[model samples]
Target: MSEFEWLKRAHAYDEADAEDLEGRVIAALRTVYDPEIPVNIYDLGLVYALDLDEDAGRVDLRMTLTAPGCPVAQTFPGTVEEAVRSVRGVDDVHVELVWEPPWSRDRMSDAARLQLGML
Candidate 1:
């Protein structure tokens, strides 16, 4: 293959790898839950942003709690980081707690709403 074609193919492979890693990271996030809620964090829509660098095996996540005064606020980010770090390909995990948008029932996924009887 020409050099240009080879570069394109490599880029495609990298994208696919990144996507796969993102999926796994999301799955890991789903395994974490708020102590006060039965639903997973992912379904709760607390996870605002996920930046995964597959090549570096690093994941940067921005999330928020349902309430600022929620009891776990102090340690929740660490819990989230640990969960994400448990993923096979994740060598580094950083969890950032954000309250800018603030979490609300509206942020919850439909599934979460249904599970919580909000639907």
Candidate 2:
């Protein structure tokens, strides 16, 4: 094969690997629960975005809490970072707390809503 074809294959492999890594990272996030809520962070819809840099083995998570004055506000971000860092291939994790759109009950997953009896 030509060099360009080889590079294309390598890039495709990296993208697939990135996708798998993203699934693992999400699974890790699912293990983290909100101190006051019974639901895991992922199902709770607190996570706004998940970005992975496979080349650097870095994961960036953008999230928010149910409310601004949540009691675990100080520690929640750290908890998320720790969870993501525990993933097998994650070299670094950055958790950013955003409040731009704010969190609402409607943001939660249907399962989460059902669990809380909202549905």
Local accuracy by lDDT, each model: 0.80, 0.80
lDDT of 1 by residue, 1-119 (tens): 85334433433433445448887777666667778999989999999999989899999999999999888999889878877776768899989999989898888899999999999
Distance from true location, Cα of 71 in model 2, Å: 1.4
Q: Number of clashes in every candidate structure?
A: 0, 0
Model 1 — TM-score against the truth?
A: 0.82
TM-score of each: 0.82, 0.82
> Over the full model, what C-alpha lDDT does candidate 1 score relative to the true structure?
0.80
Residue pairs whose backbone atoms clash in candidate 2: none
